[model samples]
Target: MATIKDVARVAKVSVGTVSRVLNGSSKISPESYKAVHDAARQLGYRRNAVAQALVSKTSKMFGVLVSDVGVPFFGEMVKGIEEVARQKGLHLLICNGYHDATEEKNMIEYLLSHRCQSLVVHSKGLSDEELIQYSREIPGMIVINRYIDAIKERCVFLNNHQGMHIAVSRLLDSHNGVAYIGSSEDIQDATDRYLGYQKALEDRSIEFNEQWVVHCEPVAEAGYKAIKQLAEQGELPSSIVTYNDALASGVLDYLHGEGIKIPEQVSVVGFDDIELARYLYPKLTTVRYPIREMAEFAANLSIQLLEDATPSVSDEELEFVPKLIERNSAVI
Candidate 1:
């Protein structure tokens, strides 16, 4: 029930000075700010956020729109973003698009309309033009994991090329040959990873085998079916590298059911070291993506953009190289 006027009177400052301190304007003197805060705390003063937002045009909330919240990769990134947002005294408004392009577009528009301070998005099907238009309007938005050339400065992604190179290198050296499973080759990440695999094989003077590449949805069921098809054809490779832990788990489950030994019969490696990787029957060897780092960086960058920090928008898109996480699934 205590008001700003009461705090100002107690702190021996004008209401405007008290307002500056509460709003984090950074223009108030330190002594005045401390006194104002003390008075507010003593009086149990609470801010009317709805009224403040109407007056100042700021909600102090950030919107996070993800393509698939069910994915472990996105979940880890959200954890990192949320941590940073909490430190900055900002609230997160999460929206899950469930891999639906229409839902993603609608969510983006809705967040902006609600005066979200900024937005961090992980999209699977948004077009480059749509992204650019969205950024042009809000201007403090960031797209995670996927790259849009038109909105280059607004995107942050993983170093998939290097990750695939590392994965393929281990497979080639440790086994005579390897196969790829999960996702269609048309997808940008899948294509880049496939190219990296080809490049590594070429570097080692190993012939590229197109037959070894299996394209499907990036899901456990897809991976299971891919392997089952290979088994039926009697075309199993000596080793396999998967798009993510989901696919790897599927492969492990399928192979185990068939009484096929892992690493001894066929080594398996995966990308994205999900939490389940370490808990699997045979711990998975995978890529340790800097998801938390990337998420926090993106969140902070969005805040910088919101604050009109000129150089924040000047920086190019950033990518973090994933390191291999060795475990029982792949030979050291």
Candidate 2:
């Protein structure tokens, strides 16, 4: 309802003086600044964010693109990024790509159109070449959970292969019949984790069997159906490694319904170490994904790139290793 012109007229000062005062320009005298503030408060005047951003060539806003905002994994990642963004007096512009390449590209373009100077993206559908092109276009763009050799310096990712390897190794040590419930998504994480499972089996001289592996969507329902299918086919293993904690929860529920005692009949291990894993009846033994830490690092990296224009990645931060968290679900 109020404008800068009205404030200037009411304050008996020129529009330029009002503008200077609003922008916190030190050139304005104390008298003019006080008068402008008093008039703005009386008139209920507010500064235009878009106009100010245009003048400064940037906004105090950061962008984040995630697969799904509702998923706990992305929720934790956002929390991490938001923590750093809040400390910097910046706001976040969050968008969900829903694991679609076209949708991911659109979200990135939207953020760029809004003049977002820094971005932390969790993209699984976009190809390496497309992501590389984006990295070249935006120096402040940082990729999380995936790696591209061309833009390695801008990537904050975990060693999924090593994580699965450790999980499978622990399961195989005490159980001869080990199975894998993997994600059917055509993402790098799924592929690397499957390979890790195989590698761990090879290390222990255990023969790999395709029948023992089940691939489906990385969700609780898929996990439930996969386990049921394995049971029907008479291919259920003595122990199983799941793609994530959500899947493990489903397996636990199905096993419990069938009156199967965990660690005694069928041991289960999961990845990501999500909060739900701890609350499960037979608390999950899992690999900690450290998504929050990686997201925080990625957010800070994006800001550093904007500030220094030539940001360097530290060895410690770039390559995060997953840790094994033993719990009630698995046995020695």
Candidate number of the best lDDT: 2
- Cα deviation of 91, candidate 2, in Å: 0.5
lDDT of 1 by residue, 49-156 (tens): 433444687587888998667788889989989998999888888888765678988787667556676689887767778778777766568888877777777788
lDDT of 2 at 221: 86
Q: Model 2 off-target regions past 4 Å?
A: 1-58
Kindly give the stretch of ten consecutive residues in candidate 2 with the minimal lDDT sum. 46-55
Q: 47-166, model 2: which lDDT tens digit per residue?
A: 644344546876888899999999998999999999999999999999999889999988887786576778999999888998997887676889999988888889999999999999
**CA lDDT, every model vs. true structure:** 0.81, 0.89
Give the number of the best model, judged by TM-score: 2
